[model samples]
Target: MNDLVVQTDGLTKRYGERLAVDSVSMTVRRGEVYGFLGPNGAGKTTTLRMMLGLIRPSAGTVSVLGRPAGRPDVITRVGALVEGPGFFPYLSGRDNLRTMARYRNLGDHAVDAALARVDLTDRAGDRFKAYSLGMKQRLGVASALLGDPELIVLDEPTNGLDPAGMADMRALVVSLARGGQTVLLSSHLLTEVQEICDRVGVINGGRLLREARVDELRGEATLRVRAAPEEAAIAVAMRVAGENSVRRTPLGLELDLSADAAPALVRDLVAAGVDVHEVSPTERSLEEVFFEMTAEAPTTKEKVA
Candidate 1:
């Protein structure tokens, strides 16, 4: 349809001297899952608030589902779980859902179905005050799902969740997307972003760093060849890498690059008369990519800061 579910351009906000959210531009494709990832105080919450219209932007604009974000007309197609889902703490989880339904005018079955979706039906009757942190989080998710929204935005849904709860949250998010729901999720957990997000926008210090598909962000095909006689392997590695980091291991030196690039590096090694053996990549994890991209050692960011 060439339509975007969420989009922003130069969407900025500030409070006096502090720019809470820098000029940020982002887009969520009509039917794709997009994750917003950043560290604490990276302006994630501020940006999200702007997107949802909870607060007015100091400058810039936001559009959701083609309408101005937070416009009354947009709420029907959009659901949200922001800042851990504030609910009536005095009400039972069941009552909380029931109250929300009253306003949506959703059928009685809708609440039960939503609770079942999160596997919190058994705990529905528990008072919000008495529920564990994870249970509360689940209830919030149930609330967001009540209206069968096409686009759902969640912020830190796994906060204080135990491992099992986190797993459940992940399953629900993926299941929602599979069911044709578009989700915009924000989280500080890099692993969660890598797991459930199809694409991600990395934010740092109130700025957008990059956005790419999960696979592209991780990069494919780096082979680590650990061979003995470190000095000899490096002589060959130098020709291909020149500046890439090469660590000395007891077995050999590790070569970091794409698998396709591996052939060129290998060819360089052969041309340099170095024998290569035992090549493998250290496990591929988002953590590795995160560290590699955001490494604080030194870069343009620091140069400007």
Candidate 2:
């Protein structure tokens, strides 16, 4: 079987004078969570909609599960929640699922299984209107799972969630991926994307700036050292790593060297008679990368330990 569950080629969308999404192309491998990350109005949602066939692209093509996206057979294999889910307010959660299942030609057992997968069985009897926002989101996920979809596309699933709710959502997404499900998660939250996505496609101003594994995009790790005679410590770091690679920080000196070099760097500083209080590895946060990619101005690297 092909490993790629989703693929887009030159996916572009225009709104008369405005270019909503500029010639974007991306791929999502099977069984991995792919985060579509971008700030507001960056066209993350638009691209997702195009992928799901909710909207036609001005130019480009999309394929889902090895078939042209938007075809009935292809749509059946993929599930999506583009915007906030809308359920019949008068119906109970279970009833709502049952109704949707009926539309999908699914049996009651399918409804039960979907509810169980999302941990909504306990509150399945509660009216949709009475369910909490988090519960409602989970129900939406349950509905998406009704068809036992091979691919799930979610657009900002944590949009209105509180801290705890966001945590729950994260766990849910991770659990789904662990179950061998492919997921395309669209979000503007850098932390959430970094925490849950194995790979990410960063978009800005309707343009895709980069696509890379989360670990690769994290860049090189820096050794953060807190030592007395900071100048001598910095000098040692500059000697070990290039001078341009060493930067001063409020905490101490930061050397843009791999974590494996920490011991050697520390030994050099200590041999130089510097009082080494601490040595820790610090990696660039997703937020830093996001800002650096999106901002027009040159970004100054900040120490983060």
Candidate 3:
């Protein structure tokens, strides 16, 4: 069996003369949090819709849990909260979950447990209209977790959440993945995605730009070392990292060289008699990696703003 819970090949979706999603190929591994990252209107929501069969792709294919997508049984092994999950404002949170379960034919099993998972157990009986935006969102998430399906697709799950609410949602997502559920989570929050996602597929202009595991990315090494006496250290950094690779950093001259070249770097530094204070890997955050991997041109709006 394929290790991927969700796979799309050359997934294309166009609206009239406009292309919303263009030949987007992405995968979500069976037990990993795969972040579908892009800016607003970069086709993230459209992509999720296609995966959930809410919208069909104009071209290409989608598969979920070894079964073909767009099939009647596709939803059987999937639970998704697309965009903001729409629910009846009149119904109580518990009633809403019950309705969803009944519609999905799950028949009253662990409804309260799902509610408790989202920290909505006490408010389960509160009318949806009376619930705050965060509370309603939590309820929607609770509904999605009802079936405990193998795959869950969430689009901008933390969109309206405040700081504490965002923290709560983050924990909930991590818990879902830990429970052996594959998540195709779409978010524009690079920092948060970097923290939680095992792998990420970055999108720009409706196309997949990069796919990398966190470890694979972390393995792309650079070193940050401080030299007690500055000039000798700079010269050593230049030799080890090459003249173009050395940069003056806040601490000292930074070496943008492979981690494997550390011995040569240290030897050069030692020969120069530069007191090396700390030699460690420079951890590049996902946002920095995203900037490096994408196009150089700034957004039109960024220029305007």
lDDT of 3 by residue, 118-148 (tens): 8888988889999888887787777778878
Off by over 4 Å in 2: 297-305
lDDT: which candidate is best?
2
lDDT of each: 0.80, 0.86, 0.80
Worst 10 residues of 1 by lDDT: 296-305
Candidate 2 clashing pairs, residues 3+ apart or interchain:
none
Better by TM-score, candidate 2 or 1: 2
* Residue range 120-158, candidate 2, lDDT tens digits: 899999999998888898888888888788899987788
Model 1: residues >4 Å from true position, as ranges?
A: 230-251, 256-277, 291-305
- If both were scored by lDDT, which would come out higher, candidate 1 or candidate 2? 2
User: Is candidate 2 or 3 superior in lDDT?
Assistant: 2
What TM-score against the true fold does each predicted structure earn? 0.84, 0.91, 0.86
